[model samples]
Target: MTPDEPRSRLADLGVGPGAFTRGRHNAITDVSGVLVGHSTVHTDRLHTGVTAIVPAELGAERRWLPAGLAVGNGYGKLVGATQLQELGAVETPVLLTSTLSVYRVADALLGHMLEQPGYERTTTLNPVVGETNDGFLSDIRSRPLGDAHVSEALTAAAGGRVAEGSVGAGAGTVALGFKGGIGTSSREVPVGDGRYTIGALVQSNFSGTLSIAGVPMPADELVSAPPAETVGNSCMIVVATDAPLDARQLTRCARRAIFALRGVGSDFSQGSGDYAIAFSVGNGMPPADATLSPLLHATLDAVEEALINSILMATTQVHADGNRAHAIPLAAVHSRLAAAGVI
Candidate 1:
């Protein structure tokens, strides 16, 4: 496909819908008041970039939102984890970038937040930044990102269709042996006289056996075998919702998001850093415990599709070091899924 060609998503392949209905954009931005943007650095040697997720409601007022985090594995440099866990809330927009560039991006994010109208007297801020290693396809040690990129992403944030695959923090990422990048999906659930939306965005860069709708891809059918070096990378999952969930409920939702990895065949290896952060933008009393089942189910479905979309929407990438990550063969995948009666 050409650079400008829109990549296909899970639904585009005729996959069946899950229990809940999907949101308009089928992205995290489907959750009202949430915006997403990316700043990509795609040079010959640098394939890394930064992505910003802004809860628009937190604008200049910088109001805190209920949030929770869950970790499947602990092999990453996720900034602001302890503080987020301790406070059970997030006060600034979340950022994602290359592994080594986490601290730099966090600093830039802090600067961006402090400059907001209401933070003039702010003394402390926990800038949540997440990362996955893009070293195989980028010169990661060079740390190519800066404040400009962070500002670009934050300023460009908007609520609409999100660009996925080989962009933003996922630009150089490898996942399930393929060129993994960014992917997103959202679902809407109905409660008592109201409805809520749960959306998931994933930076997929972990090792796994590729699976679609519970059907595993045969080894002989793969266009290319996963490289030995692609075995122990990480994945960052961000879940957003309009549900009036507290930190505890959001944490449960985040755990479900991480669990969705199993559906996509993630091994959750010792060296892999698998993490999920969930936040809510809605303000009101949360639904009862019984009503949360559908939300949790929606989280699982959205995250699973998001992971698959990360692989499907990505384009092949090559690094300055002569290493390469190939995009999954779409035709072969379609045939495999069709033959398995999955589509």
Candidate 2:
């Protein structure tokens, strides 16, 4: 889209992102010190790539950040998970990529981290890598993804507006029976001492009845156009905040955020491996009861909107092999939401 042209995002279409104040960039990167980057492989040979989230600057002294993992379903590969769970900290950048490339990305991440200024004697480093299958529209067996793509993503990661939809790990992903990909949003909530921010990034590839603000799509249309078995299979959600919290608290926050998926009509199919990972970067005390409630609510709003953004921002793409994924029609969604008085 051109600078003078309008983009098709939920807010632009009058869809709500919940009852919270948005961050400056209205993205996950709005959280302090968080940076995002993507490397999209769109050639005929490869329709996949990587999206990287750098919690802190690569050369920053504080390499580790407090984090937690919430497994909505345990049916996919997530490297560094074991150590992350055991230590409740993440020392390296988080990488999101296609399912089969998780290993290669992890290997690349390790190499990248080791080369950092202070990792000279580091014998072991945990690289957080999450993924979802994108083999339906793209040729997965090609294995075209590699360290170079990882390097590119990591190299460009920066704190600002994150590029969304049909990019990086979400390049070939399908969601809610439509084109789904990388999406992000952020919100600011009031805490006891002050305010904290909650940001979300989603890789949506799961399918179910399509609903927006409790208005389900015409049941007949969904039945007639059921989700292609090869797509709409899983999702990866990442939550970031500048608040001070340990892994356990973040895990709880992640669990609470999953409800947003249900609000958007996710059936959590057997093949849909829904996972949410949360982390905090600041040094303040944990949020109080009142503050946590609003934070959780705002997170749900951000997650729901982010997931929708993934679909809205993507464009319908046809693969060389003839497979195709259609983008959700934004004009149609706006009309429906308006009729239901949800906008």
Candidate 3:
């Protein structure tokens, strides 16, 4: 069997870096009160869907999560980012979908928010939506992801182990010429008081050379690989933490996440629109600067693993239009990392 066929994430390889511990689920949902849901539409002609991340109860109208935005490259359409940057908070659930499907998802999310018990008569709510183009593998022009699909995901939101790869907004996405999708991981940072959990989720749809555990994917496998293509040029990162942090600290965590992206070989090309959004469920303000290193370090490591998990958990896919995206070969990747003394 080919390495790409393996069903596993980065931790399954036992080569991930960092000294921090992981949460029970090793997913973003490990952060208290965080929930993730996905609605995938993978058919012969259309392969796209929506993913919703909820940090609080749906009916809490006045309650909002402290959030921050960091743009690795400003080539994205993260709706409500201006407000998030200015106000440092998000009032509605976060949804991600195909590039062309973002608007519909946003509208549907707005409906869901307004319909929530406390939002009655609430004039305007900023819906946070992000996207990557799935045009190459799917008929993105068809805009198959609609309000109903978005509602399904919202309704399905729950906390626990999350489904990854080839699902949600990542259904038809490609990354680094490989089959890329939704991936998640978490890390727990120990402090003098108590350990805090930091979790990360990524919709990886950017292009770059695949690297695992600090080693480049071996070239021999690439030479024998089937043809693959990148449909989108962006990545969306969502980081959640149980630690008491304000929007400013979350923004710093996201900046560290961006640095972690480079560790996985992301080229950050001009066409790429990489963005990271981070939030905390706690109401307390950020900690002292000296004490924030653990959080930043935790974010860096988790983001790296989350990005790696996207390709590792993905399987090669063939689109109806004859375009294809190969999965990053896991066995070859492990072997290469071993040869490089990185594992």
Candidate 4:
């Protein structure tokens, strides 16, 4: 792997240095009240897990969190599109499971929510669930995940340092032909005349020709031999912020994650369905009732920073099947930057 800074978290990857800032942990948890949890299932045959992202606030009427969605490619599945599109808001936690396990995970999430004291009284429920393929090293057809796993992940989540690399759903995945799974990063943006936080968590399963910032490199020289393309891959990006942005604006920010992914050498191949979702944990001040032009610009800035953090923070991983993928090295990256006159 390229020797950048021996970092396992995305924030340490070093992007747009000395300008935009980062949170304490350089994770989506930097956004106040955002909590993340994961349930990984790795056996002799199957390897996969479920990651749950809990927004600090819940319900359509709760005026603390505003959210948005961006779909780069629609070939994949997401459970809450209709409600999110209709009301421009989400009321439940965001869950990321394998492609075929969406329904089971969603049901489990809803059931888990009902068990909570405040959530049971609610009439309607909608849990946002996203997924990617992990069939390469995992026996996906086994449906390793169940209600208990989803509930455990959701209840166990808390805001703070989030573990990465094989700890969660990313456990059995691959990136650019190497072992890939979950990666996270964050950025602090100037807001209200000061700095506010925005961060991202990504399930990195996309494919490419294996380049660090578009500079093609030999595989064995850096990461282990690339994996066989059994199934086309995809990614699910979750952006979290304390900035007050409506759904449309949050979506605009979400799509910009592609820029950061590309900067890290992801080409968004044909089979890759790069999807992103953004949420604001700030007091969900209504757009209809409030007027602030400067806040909009601040929101945009946060989105860009948050997206870049996701890639810069991700590190390489090795899976149970004896397959390994290394993070793009920084030493080689420096040479490429100087050669391209980018430095």
lDDT of 3 by residue, 243-319 (tens): 87888888998889888788887888888889999988865556787888888988988988888888788776667
lDDT of 2: 0.81
The global C-alpha lDDT for each of the candidates, from Candidate 1 onward, is: 0.88, 0.81, 0.82, 0.66
What are the per-residue Cα lDDT tens digits for candidate 4 across 1-343? 2233554332233333335655687678888888999887766666678898988676444622456777777767789877776777777888988877778888888787667676656777777898888777666787778798897788778888887655467766666655566666676665544456777888877765555434554445554455434244787888887776677767666767545566555667777777778888765443431333344343334433433333334454434656444555556655665676545
Question: Where does candidate 1 clash, by residue pair?
Answer: none
lDDT of 1 by residue, 161-198 (tens): 99999999999998888788999999999866579999
Listed per model in order, the count of residue pairs whose N, CA or C atoms clash below 3 Å is 0, 0, 0, 13
Per-candidate TM vs. native? 0.96, 0.93, 0.95, 0.81
Tell me how far the alpha carbon of residue 14 in candidate 1 is from the true structure, in angstroms, after superposition: 0.2
Runs of candidate 4 with Cα error greater than 4 angstroms are 1-7, 10-18, 59-64, 192-194, 210-221, 227-230, 284-343
Candidate 3 lDDT for residue 193: 67
Per-residue lDDT, model 2, residue 262, is 88
Candidates 3 and 4 compared: the better one by TM-score is 3
lDDT of 3 at 15: 72
- The local lDDT score (0 to 100) that residue 169 gets in candidate 4 is 70
lDDT of 2 at 320: 75
Residue 242 miss distance in model 3 (angstroms): 1.0
Model 3 misplaced stretches (Cα beyond 4 Å): 1-4, 218-220
Cα error of candidate 2 at position 115, Å:
0.6
Candidate 2: list runs displaced more than 4 Å: 1-7, 57-60, 218-232
